[model samples]
Each structure stands twice: as C-alpha cells, then as structure tokens.
Target chain A: MQDDAKLIEFIKTDLARGKVTGKLGANDDLIETEILDSLGIMKLILFLENNYAVKISDEDLTLENFTSIMSINSLIQRKRAAQGA
Target chain B: MDFSFTDTQVLQRESIVEFARRELNDKVRENDQAGGFPLENWRKCADMGLLSLLTPEIYGGLGEDLVTTANSLEALSYGCEDSGLVHAIVTQLCCIVLINLYGSPAQKERYLPELSSGGMIAAQSITEPDAGSDVLSMRTRIEGDGAGWLLSGGKVFISNGPLADIIIVFARCGAGKSAFGEISCFLVEKTAAGYSMGKPLQKMGLRTLQNCEMFFDSVGVGEEMLLGKNGHGMFIFNEGIEWERALMTAAHLGTLERVLGKSISYVKTRKQFGKEIGKNQSLSNKIGTMKLNLELGKLILYKMAWLKDQGKRATLEASLGKLFVSESLKSACLDAIQIHGGYGYMQECDLERDLRDSVAATIYSGTSEMQRNIIARMLGI
Candidate 1:
C-alpha cells in the first residue's frame, strides 16, 4: 500500500509537471474524465511495469484496470504485492 | 506546472532519437534527391511501432495513446532528417486510427494487425480537386449493390496513395442531403478490382511521401466495410482532427527547437565579423522566438491532449493551435535559414530542407485558411 501511495505520488508528480492537474483531487475516475489519454496511460504502465514490479500486458491496460485513480492504485498495489515488493 | 515526460516517456523519446539519427539523418537528402521513398527505413519505422500506436491490442497493435504517439513523433522528427517519411507516417496513423476507432470488428480483425506490423500501408482519400478545404463538396458516391456497395469516385492529392495496402475512402451515400450527412468512409483493399492508384506526384515538400491521385470506379465493398455508420464518417473524421491538426505537428515544433539549438551551438562557435554571432541581439531574438513557439506550441498541444482525454470537444482549441503552429513553423524555418546566412540557403546545410519542408505545414491536414474558417465559425462568424 505504501508502494501504491508512492506510485500515486509519482503520477501526481507527472500530472503536476504536465500541468494536467494539481493533485488529482478525486481518488477515483480521474483517468476516465480525460485526465489521461492512452499515451499518458501507457507512460503510467511503463512506470508501474518497471518500478512497481508489475507485468502490464496489453489486456491489463484497458478501462477495467485503469479507468480510475482508485483502480490504477489498486492495480499497482496488487501487482506489487504479487511481485512480493 | 510539470508538463514533460516521465522517465519512461523520456526513454521512449531517446530510443527513437537514436534510431532516427542512426538510420535517417544522412539518408534523407539522398532519398529526396533521388525522388524515391526510402523503403528500407519505412519498414524499420513500422517494426519500431510508428504504425500501430493506436490500434487496440486485441488486434495486435501496441494501441498507444495520443500523447505517446505525439511525443514519439516529435522525437523522431527531431532526430530524423526526412519530413516526407514523417508525413507518410502521419497519413497512415490518421487513416488507421479512424478505422480502429470506428471500423467494424471484422475490419479490425482483418486489417489492424498487418497495419500495426507494417505489412500494409493505408491511405486516406478525402480531398478532391474541387473539394480541397470543403471536404463534403466532393462528387464521389456509393450506391447499393447486390451484397455490398459499389463506390465510384476519385480522390486527389492523397498521401501514401501509391503504396497503400488499404485505402480508406469517403463517398456520398445519399443525394440531395447535407454533405455532412450523406458521406460515408470505407476500407478498400489495394487488390480491389476497381480501385487503382495513380503514379506518385511530385510535391514541393514531403517529396518522398507517395502522394498520388486515386480512382475508385465501382469499387465493391461489403456491408462490413462501412465505418461507424452510414453517415458518421464526418463524425469519426472530426473526432481526431483537433489532435491531428493541432498536436500532430509536434515534430514540427520539435524541429523548431532543434533548429534553435543548432543555431545556438553554431553562433557560439562560428566567428562572424571576427566575433561569435551570439553577440548580436537580432540573432538572439530569432532563437528566442523559436524557443517561444516551441514552448507555446507544446502547451497548446498538451491542452488539446488533455481535453481529448477528458472527453471534451476541442475543435476550436485545435483550430487555433493548428493555425498558430503551422504559421509559426514557416516563420521559424525562415528565421532559422536567415541565421544560417549563406549556408542556410545552400543545400549543404539542413536549413534549406527545413524551409522547404515547413512550406507544407500550412497546406496539409486542412489548409491554414480552412483552420481560420473553422475558428471564425466557432467564434460565430
């Protein structure tokens, strides 16, 4: 969970820098509201895949796992936990 | 605040830069001189994911987002020497993104995988001699046939026309209706009996891109060929135009930055009147303006990307961005050329190429005039 928080911070860091948003005010559905496009989503995927020790196949990047901040946070958490990170 | 790349996006840009510098920088001049497409490097681009960034993964595409694709194109543009190849990639992506977003599943199953992998190149045919900026004014039409529709029309100035594996075409589906409501786009294979491509046409810029005239004489297409709906071609095409016009010139923005960087390096080193040209205010302002355009253009593109991601309509924003960047690039290229002095005018330095290439930014993806028209209408003109 701490790792997930870190990932969220990292993403928020990107958002802040990109001037996308200040802090991702809501925890859920940030992605679906057009806060991030597929490119931003892919960038998030690469970060998670490398840093959080998750294997993000093409299927995992869909709306199901990535539609919201909460879902993305959960996905990061689950993947890290599974990887024993 | 922090509108730049994450570490991965940075690496993506770097990798493409390396590939382009290693493969494209030197060959661009030769290919342009020869008036030939660089077939070898094109496939290399496909292998590297330039072609399939948007097709959904189920169909074997990397299915990258608009942001990733935009960044990648910019990086590639900065490193590579060929604007024509970049334009060709744009044409392919434009057509393919439309198909993936709106084409039927069967269409997806049949085409996306090959397109992503570069086994097929697609062309979009919408412009006509009489219908340049006004897209719906074209006279092409599709009437009902036995099990499919027989399309008959011609599209001119089609990018990637001579080399396309599948051509996405728009034709009128009903008479005496709003052109917007009467036209539909379709997917037709190169091998389709009645679909024929003309010889590649000479272009003032984008010379290596295979822009050509195309003919569709009773080209028969199945019911599955209908993209989106019978009359939704306009909708699907409009959906991506903002990004296409506004942000797709990301590479051009990058080119301005690259040119500015080159000028900075040269001015500091090259002695002019027995002193570095960096000592001049005029030269410094030239680079400053280039830098200004780069940063401003990026912000505009970033806003469009953000807006599109948010499910917001960005037509007005897009037109403004397109208008600003397209005109800025032409001006930047001219300024860059001026800074290079005699060398810039000569073919030896890359500045002349930049100047020639920047000429088309106002023409393609809808002319700058058209963008103004769109913007004016949005402003209630």
Candidate 2:
C-alpha cells in the first residue's frame, strides 16, 4: 500500500495494458514510447493525487516528473517531504 | 439518477430560449451570406450573462455548474437559427473556460471581468498549417530571454481570431524528454508588437463566425502572461480539449432537437401521393432514427455533464460523446434534407444551411477520426 508500489500497480494495470507492446522497466519512458499519452498522463496525475493525497500543481506537470515510475516516485517523495509528513 | 431539471434550471433554460429566439435571429441569412460575425448578438448574450455561465461569481459570472451551463447552451442553440453565432459563442466560452481553469489570481482579475463582460473577445491559437489534429507537432516556438518570453509562430483556422482582443497562444518552450512535454501557453494581447491577423478566412460553412490565420512574430510577453507553468502547455491543452469535446458542443444536442422538429413538421404536413410523408414506413423510419439519435445524444451529453460537475476525469466519456453527437448531427441533417427533398436543397428552406453547418461539427473540436483514435488508444489498441 506504499505510494511507489501503488503507483506502479495502477500504471501497469490501468494505463499500460496492451498499449505498451514492449517490456516496460522501472525507468522506461512512458511518454516517448507512447505507452502513456495525454489522456494516460492525466489519468496518472489524477491517480497520484487521489491515492497519495498529494496535489500535483501546474509546475509539477512535466515529463521529467512523470515519464517513468521512478520519476513519479521522486515527485511524490518531494511533495510529501514539502508537506513535512 | 435524477433526470428532471430543477426549477431554477428550467427557468434559466426557458429565459435563454426566449431571449435567443427574440434577439439572436435577425439578419442571420444575410450575415451567413456575407460571412459576418454577429457582434450585436454576441453583446446581447453578454448582457444576458450567457458569456459568464462558467465564471466565478467574484468575476461577475453566473457560476452555473457544467450541467446547468450545458442545459442553457442547448436551449440557446434550439432557439437560435444561426449556428455560426452559437459556434462563436462556444468558442469564446472555451477561451474563458481555459482562463478560469489555469489563469493566476492576477490574470483572472485582469481578464475575467472583461471576458465576462464581453469587452474582450478571446481565441485559442493551437492549430497550425501543418498541425490540425496533431497539436503537439506544432512548430510554434517560445523561447525564454530571462526577462520575458519570445513567441514566433503562425496559427490557422483559429475561431474568433480576426476580432479577438486577446489570444491564448500555445508554443513549444523546451525539448524536455518528449515532444509533448515542452509546450507552454502564453496570453498574448492582440495589440502586442509583431502580432497580426490575416483577413477573415471564408469557409464552406459556419460563415457567420469568423476564422482567421494569425501570426506571432517574436511577440514578447511578460512572465505574468505565462499561463499555468512554462512546460505545462500540453496539460492545459489536454484539459481544455477534454472540456470542449464534452461541454462546448452541448449545443449540438439542441441542434438535433431543432433538426428533428423541422423534419417532423415537414413529414407531417408536406403531403405526397395525397398523404402526409409521416404516414410512409420508409420516411417515418428515418424520423424514428433521428429521434433515437437525439435521445441517445442527450443522455450521453447529460451524463458527461453530470460527471464533469462531480469533478471526474472524462477523457473517455468526452471522446465518445463528441463522436456520437457530431456524427449523429451530420446524419440527422442529411435525413432532414432527404425528408424535405427539393425544398431542403433550396436556400429558402434553410435545411441546406443546417446541413452545411453540421458538416463542420465533425471536423472541428477534433474530427471524428481523431475521436476514434483517442477511443482506440484508451482501449489499448
């Protein structure tokens, strides 16, 4: 139920599916590979906010932060740290 | 689960229908023939707070929720014969919706009042000569210069482009890790240096609404004008397009009702073989299909509206609704023209004009093909 595990599970199950024809690694690019498109990006953002109780503001909406499972975990960690939780 | 409109919503819809019927129909044919923008009707809608349906109350808006706003737009499109004017209103409202969604406090304070009051018209500049549906492929570049930003690009087929007081320009600001992530939106004033608009582009339909080509030749804008963040333009566009696909075309539901009404009236009264056309199984079957399409379209749109009102992500719902309603509208118009036969082909009957306007429904706000692609992608195809 940790944030990182939850994110990976949701991304692989909900967004990736058969759209990602090739293997997806932890640091593989979701956007460049077209595994996660604009709508997928949105769904991921919504999922992160809803499940993790974090607000991904406009500034946080970036490829560097959302292009991979690793990057997404980094963003969540940074946000949680800022909240001093 | 509740399908009935509240008393207040019913009153609002009735008043809007009455106002549009009384004030928005004058010179519509002439305007269409000349391809003129209905500034008078635009101002009338502003005065009636139609322009402010989605804005916050602090910014002089009626602040209607998505469902109510969709209902009001449906009533307006039903009463108003000029589809172009309705098109223009929705385009302006789309710009307003983006501003409200992404604009900073100061930006909202600066623009929302004027936008809500109709003192300033707005356009969204995204499509380019090469980029129609592939928005991220746009070559419009935005580079930073420490103090401000430089924007240089040309946008084509921009609704409200010719007369807009301000425009939301989407441009590429960074290479990022992906092509889709580097785009950023800037609020550019029409009067800004090196900003110019081409002559209003004449079109096959929706002529009463102006579409134009715009150029931003290294136009400089302050940091204050950077909507959302520097590299969040794609997100802004995605959000805006989702709204447009869902709510902007809500009027088409009303257009379906209008088309069905006209068809029904024609079939009921226009006699052939000494009997009403509605009496024929073949002709009546077409009318039945139109009715079915209208009912289904309204249900989809209303459900989309309700979902939006509940603050849900509706990418799938929006694309489905847009595809269904737009394709259905085109078919209904064709059926209407067929029902009216020779009279429908004539300008006097106005069904031909309606048909022309309906064609653009599928083309704009993402084409039916694009909708299909979005849906297929969501399905993991």
**lDDT leader:** 2
lDDT of 2 by residue, B346-373 (tens): 8988888888999999999888999898
Q: Tens digits of per-residue lDDT for model 1 on A1-85?
A: 5765666676666533454454554365654354453224434554666576677643353455665567787787777787787
TM-score of B chain for each model? 0.96, 0.98
Q: What clash count goes with each model?
A: 9, 0
Any residue pairs clashing in model 2, and if so which?
none
DockQ (0 to 1) for model 1: 0.02
Model 2 CA lDDT for position B91: 81
Instruction: Give fnat of each prediction, in order.
Output: 0.00, 0.24
Residue B94 displacement in candidate 2 (angstroms): 0.9
Docking class of 1: incorrect
Question: What is residue A53's positional error in candidate 1, in angstroms?
Answer: 40
DockQ of 2: 0.35
